[model samples]
Target chain A: MKYCSHCSNEVTLRIPEGDTLPRYVCLHCQLIHYQNPKMVVGCIPEWEDRILLCRRAIEPHRGKWTLPAGFMENNETLPQGAARETLEEANARVEILDLYAAYSLPHISQVYLLFRAKLLDLDFSPGIESLEVKLFEERDIPWNEIAFQVIRTSLERFLLERRTGAPVFHTGKIDRSPI
Target chain B: MKYCSHCSNEVTLRIPEGDTLPRYVCLHCQLIHYQNPKMVVGCIPEWEDRILLCRRAIEPHRGKWTLPAGFMENNETLPQGAARETLEEANARVEILDLYAAYSLPHISQVYLLFRAKLLDLDFSPGIESLEVKLFEERDIPWNEIAFQVIRTSLERFLLERRTGAPVFHTGKIDRSPI
Candidate 1:
């Protein structure tokens, strides 16, 4: 940040009193701007034997297949954000189930919370941010074209655990080292 | 926010094209500033039959007891952030276990991620933000003085699930309605 959003004054980076990390503090207002990891919430929108996927029409991995997900917004619960993203991306309705997996991607300062959701019906199509929306069975999933490592791993685990007739929460981290 | 941090220009809130929600957009740079919920992470530190708690020395709930937690920072995993909070608040080193509970407090735009943790040793003391740090058994917990509702609910569930021998992930929402 170059200037304070509060006072329109220049901001300086320094460790605040009693704090260990350097934060952007406004020179005039002394307001501290703290940045934290954003959450990307989505769901494994499952039907009887298939799950929904969206081909992104936006950047960062445009045109690749992905779970319907995006940066969660303020004032919404995780499940609400997940379902909203699904509606926005795939025009699909889902009953959000148990959180399937959470992966902290420190590289991008994001936490991915992917839930297992019951796809309500087959009445679905692409929203504005998607090129196409389709359901893929296990064997038909385009593993190599998955947009993100977190999604790929979560999908893999979700499919594996389905055989046991129960799904549990999983958590892990994905990091891309600094060059 | 009154000013844009990117270009020190006046900002106006408007729903950007293709966005359902309004965002602060810079007049000069056309930069969109999006705000999202932050994650607060900590753990239920287990020491055999007891778990740890810290009496707050900070403002929001000074002198009341709470689990060690704070806003998660960048470049860290959820488990790492939880463990860091434990160390910083209670001087307690812990091996963070499975995430036991997640709560979204939409009223304040925060998500609480509490994990089950193993307290490593007995050498623990209050950190700067704590007035005192101590371990308490289930029956001795100061339920009435717990700092936040999310913490209270997570603790109650944690204690109840202990007898079942398996801890599954639990998720919910807590909202304090606006006056």
Candidate 2:
């Protein structure tokens, strides 16, 4: 940040007293602006044996297939955020089951939380941020066209655990080294 | 937020085009500042038949006992954040096991991710943010003096699941109504 949002004064980066890391502190107000990682929540909506996928119409892997997800909003639970993202992107209603996968992407400062959900009905269409929405079986999934590594990892685990009759919780990190 | 951090110009809250929620939009740079929830990560450090706790030396819950938890920083995974918090607050190094409980506190816009961990050794002392650090068995826990509801919930579940041999992944919401 170039300036403080509180006082419109220039901000300087320094480690605050008793703190190990540097933060943007306002010169006048001394307001510390701390930025933490954001969460991307979504669901694996299962209909019969198929799963829902949406083709992105926005940038950052636009036109690629993804399991409808987005940046979570304030004042909502993770499951609620996941369901809302599914509805916003695919116009599909779902009954959330369990939080299946959580991947920390330190490179992008994001955590991806994906849930296993059951599609309410066959009535689904593309929303504003999606070009198309469709259900894909295991063999039909476009693995090579998945939007993000986190999504691909979650999808692969979800599909594999589906055959085991019971799904186990999965947690891991996706580290992309700095240049 | 009063001024735009991008250009040091006044920012107004308005619903941008194609968006349903209002955001702080800069008048000079047209930058949209979006605020989302942050993650608080820590662990339930298990040592023999006891778990660790820290007496708060910081504000918001000064003097109250709590798990060694704090706001997660960037460039770290959930497990790493949990382990770091445990070490920083209690001077206790841990071997993180599984992510046990995830709670979404919408009222405060924070998510708590608590893990099950094994304390590496018995040599732990209070850190700067803690007045004292101690290990408590299930019957000796200071339930009423717990700092936060999320900590209480996590501790209760960890103790209960200890007898069951396996801890199921727990997810829930904490709603603190305005007084």
Candidate 3:
């Protein structure tokens, strides 16, 4: 950060006393600006035998299919955030079963928490952030047109463990090449 | 966030086009600063029949005992962040078994991800942020002296599920009254 968000003073990179990492400390107020990884909570919303997916209407992967998700907002639990994202992106409601996948993307400083959920109904359409919303069976999934790598992996894991109907816990790192 | 960190321009809160929530939008650079919940990763470091606990040397809960945890940083996985926090808070090394508990503290905009782990050795002391580091058996735990609500709940669940020796997945929310 060039300027302190707190005092509008200039900031400098320095390790505070009794701390290991250097942070952006305000020149006047000494307010430390700590940047932590954010949680991107969403769900694998299932309807009958099909899973819900949204086509992006915005940049960074426009028109690519993805599980409806977004950044977790303040004053909401992970599952609550997941449900909110689903409603926002796809105009869908879901009953969250369990947290299914947590992929740590150090390259982007994001932790994606995907829940295993059942869609309340098939009454879903594209929200503002989505070009369209649709349900896809495993064999009918547009694998080549998937959005994020983590989403693709989540879909794969979900399909793999579908037989047992057991919630799968997954943790992995995504090494995305810098654009 | 009064000023845009990118351009040092004054910012205004507004809901962007097609967005539900308002964000800190810069007037000059049009940079939208969106805040999200952060992950606090740590472990319940177990050494045989006891678990490690640290007394905080910092504010928010100074002098109270808690499981070693801190905000997850950039360039780290969930497990790695948990391990790092354990090492930093208690100067203890641990072998992480499985992600045991995840508690969402919406009142604080934080998610606590606690892992079930085995302490590598007893050669551990308090780190800079901790005044004291010690091991306590289930019965010897200072239940009243526990730091945060999540920490107390984590300890209780750990004790309750110790008999099965199987990792438990828990997700819950905490509501704090405004001071």
Candidate 4:
């Protein structure tokens, strides 16, 4: 936001009249620019009694396991994003059953939305981003080596709710500091 | 992505002789990286036969009308994100009714999920990122000036579904060209 959109002038970051945080304000248009976090949508795609998982072929969490997930694209709906990610990562078609989890990480400025999906077919292979694609039963999850905190939490909740057959809702800020 | 996780060393991004797209290949630790998109969730909150709309105080479309929406946070559900966005933008509580629309836009790299929610109370005001907040009947919607293509399409489908009682399930690229 170095340039202003209204008057085509350069902008600067400054605190407003009654604010504490610095904001990007266009000097020409007097408009304040607000930046929000990006969104991630994916699914816990299931076939029979097992949940789908992908092995990463990239950095940040290379070789780690994760649900098929990705950043939301422009002009697409959440479900569409989830479904597309599933196909892109696992090469599988799925039917979204319900939205299972939503997570906000203010630390990284990201929000993740996950859903429970039923696999439309048993056939699947690694997509461009995945090294290997596989399914795991609840008890067989590789908990310690899961890719991200959000993925672990969503998987835990999904397994718990499935076992108890009860609706589950959890809300709290994550203590991200490492032990 | 070109390095092994177990033994830190350079790897390849080339698919095997019989494979399609290039994938991360670790020669040492045999690790791969998986890349996926994020998810965004929001709601079309309706109050007494009118829909809640907010004038965005931020870009990509500053001062444009839109439904209350934001990225899904970590450790929350899709419904929770939708409800949270509704509250954050409208200062109103809502009960989510049904999953309304899902869209995928590979161009801008986002997936948006939307829900239909019944406003719990009509009390609301513009939140931090909104210049103004108000409700409008279907016919009175400012379709041309809606903030995002996803929002415009979702609102159109929602209104049409409300009238014709036929659900909309779109699966294709969204026409995101400026109006």
Candidate 5:
């Protein structure tokens, strides 16, 4: 936001009239530019009581296991984004049953939304971003090798609720001490 | 991300041999930076069959109509994000019913996830980022003056489903032509 889109002039950071935080405001057009965090949508897709997990072929945590997820695209809805990511990474079709989780990481400037989805079929193959795709039983999850804390937490909660028959909705900030 | 986080050495973006896209490769520490898109979550909360909407108090569409939404925060889940935003802007509490839409807009570099939330209570007021808050019946919706296309489309689909009793899940790209 070095230049103002409205006025085509150089912008400066300043606290508006009575605002607390500094914001980029155009001197010419008086427009302010805001840089907001993004959204990632994915799913804990289940097939006959098994959860689908994909081994990453890409970096960050390459070869680590995670549920199929990706950034939401423009114009598509959240379920569409989740479904697309599932299809792209696991070659799986799923019907979204519920939005189970929404996570925000202010440290990394990201928000993750995970859905509880039901697999339409048992067939799946690893898509381009995955080294392999497989379904994991409750006790067989690779807890130590999960790609992100969010994935690990979501899976843990999912498994726990399945066992206890009491689904808990957790809302608040996550402690990022591990990552 | 062209510097090593571990060693503070120069890095480069490259495709390792047969890779399809470039990734940050740190030569000194052998670290690879994998960047993923962030997530934005929001909700179209319904009250007594009417949908909740807010007038933006901030730019780029200040004074325009939009559903209460914001990027997911670090300690919250998607449903929590939507609920938080609903609470923040509309001063209302909601129970998320279903994932109504998911989309990615490459043009704006954003992925938006919207949920169809059921308003838990009717008491409401405008919050910080909103100029005004109100609920509108299907025919009373200010369609032409909506802030974002995504909100307009979501409201349209929501109203349509209410009337037709048929589910609408949009997966294709939204036409962004000027109205």
Candidate 6:
């Protein structure tokens, strides 16, 4: 954040009055730009006994297989964002269930809210951002090829707890980990 | 936003190539500025049969009672953010429990993550953001004077669920409503 997005003026990083943290303050407009933690919402799309995963075509974890998820967009609920990301990445439709897990990556300032979803059909293909999309059974999951720590934990916990069919909420902190 | 925060140049709102949403793109640097929903974290601080509440000293709901919560900051977990907000608002200490409820207020592009916390001590007072901070029993809760709908719902759920001592996660969407 070098300049003010509102006035195109140079911004200074300083703590405003009555505030404890430093923020980007515009020199001319005096607008304070605060950066907060972002929510990355997605879901574990399940079809029968298999869980859907997408092979990333983008960097950060290219070629790695993971759940269909992305950053939550504006003007949408968490489940809606999770479903949208699933559609965008794998062209899959899912009935979003309970929010299954929330992993806060403090190092990256991101909170991933993943849900347990039921895949509506088998007619799904990869979107532009994915090289491939496939359903993997529990024993067939590519644990070693998973994208991030948060997603890996979500998958492991989901498979372990699915037998009970109880909607249990999971939460954790993944600081200094791959996410 | 009219200017690029990175280059101090004029920006235009347009859909970037390979993207569906229109974002603020820099004319000079071509940096796409994407916006997402934010998380507002807080907790239902409990002590015995009473719950903690803070009266606003600021606008939006001036003088009305509310649970301590604010926009989640960077470099912290969801539970940590909830604890920080409780300490900041009421000058109180709390042990953050499981994430109790998640309410998505899409009207403002914000998600409220409220936890069930245990108040550690009674040595508390109002902080800069609050006019008064006090503990209230279930029957004495100010329903009409509650600050936000989310807080009200969280408090109601907390009291109702504490009886069984069961931890049940709650989720909802508060679109086109006061938050």
Candidate 4 C-alpha lDDT tens digits along B4-123: 433446656777543444666665566553334455678888777799999988877998999998766545656777898888787889998666665666666556777778998878
Per-candidate DockQ vs. reference:
0.88, 0.86, 0.76, 0.11, 0.15, 0.90
Worst 10 residues of 6 chain B by lDDT: B170-179
Candidate 3 lDDT tens digits, B32-144: 88888889999999989898999999988798899999999987889899999999999899998788888898888889998899999999999989999999988899888
Candidate 4's residue-wise lDDT over A85-106, tens digit each? 8998999999976667656666
TM-score for each of the candidates: 0.96, 0.97, 0.96, 0.55, 0.57, 0.97
lDDT of 6 by residue, A1-179 (tens): 99998888899999999899999998799899999999999999988889999999998899999899899999999999999999999999999998899999999999999999999999999999999999998999988899898888878888888876865787998876664
RMSD values for the candidates in order, in angstroms, are 2.0, 1.9, 1.9, 9.0, 7.2, 1.5
Q: Which regions in candidate 1 have their CA more than 4 angstroms from the true location?
A: A177-179, B177-179
Cα-lDDT of candidate 5: 0.75
lDDT by residue for model 1 over A1-115, one digit each (tens)? 9999999999999999999999999868879999899999999999998989999898878888999999989999999999999999999999998888889999889999988
Clash pairs, model 1 backbone: none
Tens digits of per-residue lDDT, candidate 5, B59-153, equal 87898999999766544566777888888888898998666676655445556678878888879899888999998987898888799887777
Docking model 1 quality class: high
Q: Give the runs in model 4 whose Cα sits over 4 Å from its true position.
A: A1-11, A15-34, A166-179, B1-179
Fnat: each model in turn: 0.87, 0.79, 0.73, 0.16, 0.22, 0.92
Tell me the tens digit of each residue's lDDT in model 2 across A49-128. Answer: 99999999998888889998899899989999999998899989999888998899888889988889999999999999
lDDT of model 3 at position A127: 95
Question: In terms of TM-score, how similar is model 2 to the real structure?
Answer: 0.97
Off by over 4 Å in 6: A163-167, B163-167
Residue A19, model 3, lDDT: 80
lDDT digits (tens) for residues B46-122 of candidate 6: 89989999999999999999999999999999999999999999999999988889999998999999998999999
Residue B162's lDDT in candidate 4: 75
Please give, for residues B59-158, the per-residue lDDT of candidate 1 as tens digits.
8989899998998999999999999999999999999988988899887899999999999999999999999999998899998888888888888887
